[model samples]
Target: MSKTSLSLALATALAGIVSMPAAIAGTPSGAFSIFKNCPYTNPSVTTCLYNVVSSGSFVIGNTTLPITSPITLQGGLESVGPSPLYDAVGAPTLASVPAKVPGGLLGIANPAPDWPFPLWVAFWSIVNSVNDVTATIELVDTVQTNFLQALYPPAPDSGEDPVAARLTVRVHLQNPFLGGTCYIGSPQNPIRINLQTATTNPPPPNQPISGEPGNSYYVWVDEANYVGYIQDDDNSLVDNSFAVPGASGCGNVALGLPIITSVLDFLVSGAVNLKVGLPSAAGKNTAIMSGDTSLAASAYVLASEQ
Candidate 1:
């Protein structure tokens, strides 16, 4: 088959499971989000080198978003390795630094008010905003469009496609390990993204800003096994447009996860495979993660509407 025919065929096969007239994007069409760890070609070599790069498409009514590629124009699953988090503030000196997180992350309980998981905001494609950074308020990590494409003769698909609405969740957080100086204290910790893995603790409680409260904080012990958490303090679930972009009418747009899970794992899957999370941290969760950020630990992927 020619490249054009092969592209159409691939699009059909993928979208075939979701709706009809697969190649064309139509009412309630499907949208995709892909994360890849490509350091050689990505722009943010500092972050991209260590972090997962993201890209996807929005299947608007009747017309699939035009994919840009020299090869066939059809989205395909990614096959890349997962990257680690890092600090982006190494400018004027070096590139970036490793985040200083706490150690012994086995089965930690709710370590709230100190280090709450952040809502990872992202978009399938930039519609109104100039870039994802400005539009989503979340620091841009991986940026790409038409992120995936297929060649003629076709190939088998890899990765698992889980249910998602249109949301982004960044389980990584900023907190002081011991107390003194907070490593991820900087707003939007562009310096480093420390998780539950550090050689030493921060210091003690009550040093100043970024100090650990009660000389303690919270973190995901085993994100890979621990499902997820949607607690009361996590304000990211609420619909407050004034606070979050594209969240004006979306009241309490958040994902309900059971037993605080690791955002690292989620990002790992989203980045390595041809999958995406609904109500992306930057997108609206009017349907899925809507209402309150408070919910018992649960495992559910609110699929988007067709």
Candidate 2:
């Protein structure tokens, strides 16, 4: 082939290479999300509890909960509180708290009298930054009871009662800039959500309750981070976000009350060596400042992994 023809062929190959699709970017460090299957299980009653606990870590920006370098398990279920609807029934009427369940296990049980009413567990984590997130969830039925036991001694039970239930996991990426404001707009609010019901064990006719065994659900967010931004000028604003004063600064801030608010003034100005923005800053920060800030507890569940 002539030199001119060879040059033309090379140019064509270069053009094709340039037109190739660009590679997807990786999730930044310190940003992560959760994962699980729908219709979770009661850790105390299910044998597959290990599956939920063993799934994986929460990934934030570039730092992942349960870090790898030092093998630190930094993040886990802080506190699985009752769903908002259940909270209205009063704390005493709610299901038993999963105090016994370890941080690793994402399951819990409802004590007696409650009859295991459907509940929602809140989970939170703080990485270095924020990013878009995705999650995985799984559900499995593990136990069943005799629905007719109330009528007769043995109830002359028949086949297993069908266990039908769905799992709904909602993920909220709190923005520290908006004073821990939750990512709320329309559909982008929840980072991950899975709704599912048990497909097996069809309910018996005229039966008020299905005597099917309990089921376990697992949901996880493999990738997560912050993409939106707020216009503000406050370096103390965490993560380059806003630095809300008091508890109303960010909508998603999850700092519990009483302790933090009690000593706000003292910690911030008194002889204490308080530094704003730091995790410990909670104790010293004032909970009375202005701007848009919601109590941390109202925003995300930021507590010990128990």
Candidate 3:
């Protein structure tokens, strides 16, 4: 089985242990609950979308993090065609959801041989409390015009897909040892993921990978809404050309202690970056987001709330 599959299969086992909270919670009542986060209130917002990334893998440097938990992206678009070039939502649209990375630090499960002995002592001391490490992908910023590409992707040139979405994001590495502020990238220097629906054209070392637009369909929330049908369905976004920055602020909390906090921070950050290949260059990393998407008129979504 794939790492994602295996992680899912073994998720129950981790349940007995302390695990991170599930992603995308609190479903509101109504058929359009899936699009609950849609910005229907914005008069300029005409299109709303809801996407659930089911299974995929994110490789940063040397560490391979499988997406066992689903990550959701939802919001609305002011214009379909980039003519006007409206944003998805005035506020951040991408949900800050955590996808647990199996095997904790160094991809090693707890209670391993010589647990907390020798070199494993510092490693286990930090992550032991969290049970497992969780990586949360949070959006830092994005181009408003890129939203249209997800719906009407441009044709591929040669064999490579055109850029679909330009997303600037940071990965939050959460564990008791790393503390609450540990992160791979920050808002000022974020990882930019330029996604496409067709075959990718990576830099070097990495090979080209393909993605699908998936099937498209329409849905009518209510016949009385008198709005155009929602154009939405499944799609896959792939990118292997983005770079990943080194982690920072790890083990810099009160938990890391006072005098040795700086040392712990330096040790934890250095170990993680070295082991995971921090500051990975473009073409050395990969991200595949496979999920279903729905697009509905803001009026239709607003009407559904009634």
TM-score of every prediction relative to native: 0.16, 0.17, 0.76
Order of models, best TM-score first? 3, 2, 1
Q: What is the lDDT of candidate 3?
A: 0.64
Residue-by-residue lDDT tens digits, candidate 3, 1-306: 232432332233223212222333333226566666776667776656667788888888877888877776677666444423234444446654677776675462232343224335545565554567788888777544443455555656654337766778899988765678888999998999987777777999999998777766444333343333344456788999999998877764554344355655576677678767788999899999888766555554555453
Candidate 1: worst-modelled 10 consecutive residues by lDDT: 293-302
For candidate 1, give the lDDT of residue 191.
19
Q: After superposition, how far is residue 134 of candidate 2 from its true place, in Å?
A: 14
Q: Order the candidates by lDDT, highest first — what do you get?
A: 3, 1, 2
What lDDT does the true structure give each of the candidates? Answer: 0.20, 0.19, 0.64
Q: Model 2 residue 144 lDDT?
A: 23
Candidate 1 lDDT over 1-38, as tens digits, reads 34354234333333333432223221211221111211
Q: Taking the tens digit of each residue's C-alpha lDDT, what string does model 2 give over 1-306?
A: 232432333233223333333433332122111101111122221111001121123222212232111110111111121121111011121111111112111211111232112111111222124222211211111112211121111222445322111122221222321122221111322112111111211122211211211221112111121111111111010111111122112222233323243242232221111111122211121111011101111111111011
Query: In candidate 1, residue 202 scores what lDDT?
Result: 26
Runs off by more than 4 Å, candidate 2? 1-88, 92-163, 166-169, 184-306
Q: Clash number for model 3? A: 0
